[model samples]
Target chain A: MLGDQIRTRRELLKDADRRYSLRQVAGRVGIEPAYLSKIERNEVPPPGEETIKKISRDLELDPDVMLAMAGKISSDLQEIIRKRPLLFSKMLRALKEAPDHAILEVVREVTDGDW
Target chain B: MIQLKGTNLVLRFPQVHPKAKASIEFMRTLRVPNDGNTYPLPAGLGSFELEHIEDHKAQLPEDWLKRGGVMLPMFQSEAMWISFNGTYPIALKVATGKINAITGELWTNELTDEPQNYVVLSEQPWLDGYAVEQGTVRQFVATPLGSGESAEEQITGEAAFGGIQIQAFPMKREVYKELFESPKLTDEVQQYLEIPAFLRRCSEPAMGLVPGGSIAQEIHKDEYGLDAWDLSAGSRCFIHTVNSEAWSELTDLPMPHKPISARDYKSANIPWFKYYAQDKKALPGSAILQKLKSKKEKPATKREDAEIGQNMSDLPVVKLRRSDVVTEGVF
Candidate 1:
């Protein structure tokens, strides 16, 4: 899914401007052109978080969305979860199927330290 | 081609190199008094809101739909400047209604070095107006089409198009790698490459940029040479300027507030700007652009003096010099 998403967006950008070639994007992302091609074709697994961020930056896509699509979490986020494993695990499970606004409300309450 | 990323237009070159990307913003600034006196660069208040033409195809004229780009609202006589951000080296050609802002020649698909039809980034940070003279430019003031104030009306004798046109070409990939990737790259150039990621109304008459008051600004010479740009891989965008009232009617968006008057800004002790790069050379004034009469030379049709009060005397100015190191005094 991540590969499809990236490939589709890249193609759209390329359609508008012919310069967004796979090789060029790979070069900018510091990845091998062959490896990027394989990833786009879904023959290889998505790259690590750093590479994903680089690709997202080059493509002007949201890094968070790309990370979510990749089924990976950023190291900084992992650290945050690690610090409060018990509470975060419980919160994440409770909020798994929650609507975005409801989850936002909880985040707002916690951020405001109103609870 | 230009893609609307929020209000900024992102010009991408996928065929050239992924790093060969640049974003442009039209900044709202004070409309300096065009009372036959040149002034310093004004502060950028904010960006103009932009909307894609495809989204509002039903309401737009057929010609606008055919042009197929983005549109922004602008008030008559309002001043604005272009802000450029590039991840890598890019050559940008800017024109007001098919009239080249640099050479004052008619728009052509090709980039030429004889008169230097384009400005190179990230060396050149911003463009304020027509390149009338060396190290000086007349500010871009919006005027309605057919008013005979716009450069288009003056040169072409017809207001066929009443908006800005932009084309961007990135440096050849090999050339960029050889120049920038090498250890010979200067700190100043490197610093300029690392620029961080960073409107209008509807009226029926349509608006085009006219040379307003003169300002001390330079369109820097292309150090990379004309051959360095990958002219084959270039994209252009047509920016439609709609009047504020019509913009509101078409988009249902609130009109932007009037810009800060020059008098108020001056009274507040806000400093105007003067920028100088010690290493780079400024291009000479265009022979054709210099020959055309500025908006000040003609009779004023719009009441601009009332909006931008005429008290422009003794405004404080701040000078910005590049690549200067301040030595710390011994404590």
Candidate 2:
């Protein structure tokens, strides 16, 4: 599914007339054509955090979305969550219970204006 | 110790020689002048068109000719601050016609690029300058070389030629375009990201002030500090660049690898007259200058933090230095 998302986004970038090329994207990711082709075909189970981050940057996709598709979490956020499990659990529960718009607001606040 | 294979951008002047010249001065920025105005290009200081014999192109020394570059005609006392047409770095080979007895070179307002190392004359202080946000518009006043007090400091033995060859590469574009309020980074990266935004706003191709997509960056030298080249204070000159024989006794840097390209002489990319248009980059930008992308060039009082080891996170102003401090002569 993550592979599908990447392919879909790649196509979208092309359709929109943006400068997106498989080679250019792969070059930015520092990978070979065969490997990227395999990734898009879902033959590989997705890569590690670093590769995923590179993919996210080249594809202009969300890092968290890419990580989730690969069944992983950001080491930075994970470290914080692991350090204070109870607080994080409570915050997660509150986030899950919030409305969609409220959750977006929470993300913006959490990212300190970055999101 | 160096070899430059190519240039990033070229500045080609109008095919027809414009005989007009202008003499604008940088009347005091700090300590405020008696005429209480902070901004604007002061009274009596306006762009003028003068009549003079014009060389179609610069006659670079024999060394630079092989590398090839564009040229523009310049007149004495005429000064103007160049702006970056866009957000990229560049190196330039700026020169005027050679003189019979004296040779002239480009001057700068940014202090850290070892200004004294290139100073062929003294008392030709950067006629005047002012800080514009995180960037500056240094007064690049034209003077006939050797007209001012000349120093026998011997920075280079390659025939004290005139005109300037400087580069203006800062950090990579990704780093420069980041918002100023972004997170703090390493000292080196911070310094690399210290270009002022206004410096990139001289003219727009759409506006028709400059030609095409090209934006001009400062291509001169420090506004002050001609004292660092004092041989009496034990200033080291790399013989590899000077002359194998004269610099032979002073071996500070490694020997040059091969023939010196035009870009090699312009190694001072530090906010000097180097810039980017649509497709150009300052190959090896002053270690390179600001044009990166902040809004203001700081004042002298605030630039203390812009020094080595100190995190220049927040600075109000930046001023040109008169002597070597943080870099210890980084020429």
Candidate 3:
């Protein structure tokens, strides 16, 4: 039964990889295609928070898109954004427009919020 | 299009950058005055280190930035070669910073990511040329907002950037050819493989140098080197992967809780690839002895094939059975 579950999980993840070609994913997410392929093969795990947000937006995936996988669990930082869409939205806006310091401000806002 | 022909690889870039033009001059510095020996770094030509910086709102302008942004430093360690297929668009970003106990380096520096669209080689008429191909970039144009009205929506369009062919590997042209026997692959193929390798290598935890599991398959003595495999196998096997954007998502997770950095890492399994301290799977006694001993179970000889095609039986797969448990204080 455990083996069966593992097979199912692999199939599901494979579906995600096929759903988005490396080029298409890079276009939507802003990461390069070669790096994307690395993730699919599990050579490396998913990238950090900002990269994840970009991937989520590019793939139009749920905020917990990475939660579907194994290895390292989602970071508390990601959990904060997952639980609070407003904060995530504000963070994205800042990344797009604010200066480098603004990223810290977004981090502060997320950390200060009620969990 | 400028074609740089080597024994193994052929590279063609549609655009060229001004820095590449400068690199030609830079290459001269690397070349020996009379003996023609390329000196090592510092004395060879110039050298710089790469650093990674993270800033949420940092905007990159057209001009080059000495340091800034979500930078991924890359080096052309050893000898490098470049050429243009048509026109070339070249852009280079260099990073530098001091080492830190927390993350090794603060990685606080990053240059802009704009490609140099043109080059003017005054001395050498052959080298002096215009870029033939355009680069890929998306631009957003916003209309002005009215005094008492909402702002106008922005419009995006595709514009032509310069294209230039470039490659940097540990081996030099002649030496690389001698080492590999066959020529190196075209820049197009190398670029396709190298970029991903760079991101994964630079970002992932440092462990080993090998990119993936070096699985050895038995080589058969047939009329054609790899003909039998193709005849038996209909479709070639290929390992598909997730797109870069989805992969980058893993980086956002908290330090300890984040997914594994899929880039290369040392492994306990497959010591032949040389990732672990404990070695297993010892090499079999060589072939000469096999003739004396009664012929029975012979180990497979893995032959390297240059053909770029599909073989269902020989699909490449990276088996990452280990879990990444980030201990406290490692980050």
Deviation in Å, model 2, residue B207 alpha carbon: 25
Best by TM-score: 1
Ranking by DockQ: 1, 3, 2
lDDT (Cα, 0-100) at B248 in candidate 3: 32
Badly placed stretches (over 4 Å) of model 1 are A1-115, B184-188, B193-203, B296-314, B324-331
Q: Backbone clashes per model, in order?
A: 20, 43, 56
Candidate 3 structure quality by residue, lDDT tens digits, B19-121:
1221221110111011112111111122111112222214322211222212211111111111112111222211111111011112122211112111211
Question: Which candidate, 1 or 3, has the higher TM-score?
Answer: 1
Q: B171, model 2: CA deviation in Å?
A: 39
Supply the global lDDT for candidate 3.
0.23
Best by lDDT: 1
Query: Would you list the rank order by TM-score, best first?
Result: 1, 2, 3
Task: Give the lowest summed-lDDT range of ten residues in model 3 chain B.
Answer: B135-144
After best superposition, candidate 2 residue B280: deviation in angstroms?
61
Full candidate order by lDDT, most accurate first: 1, 2, 3
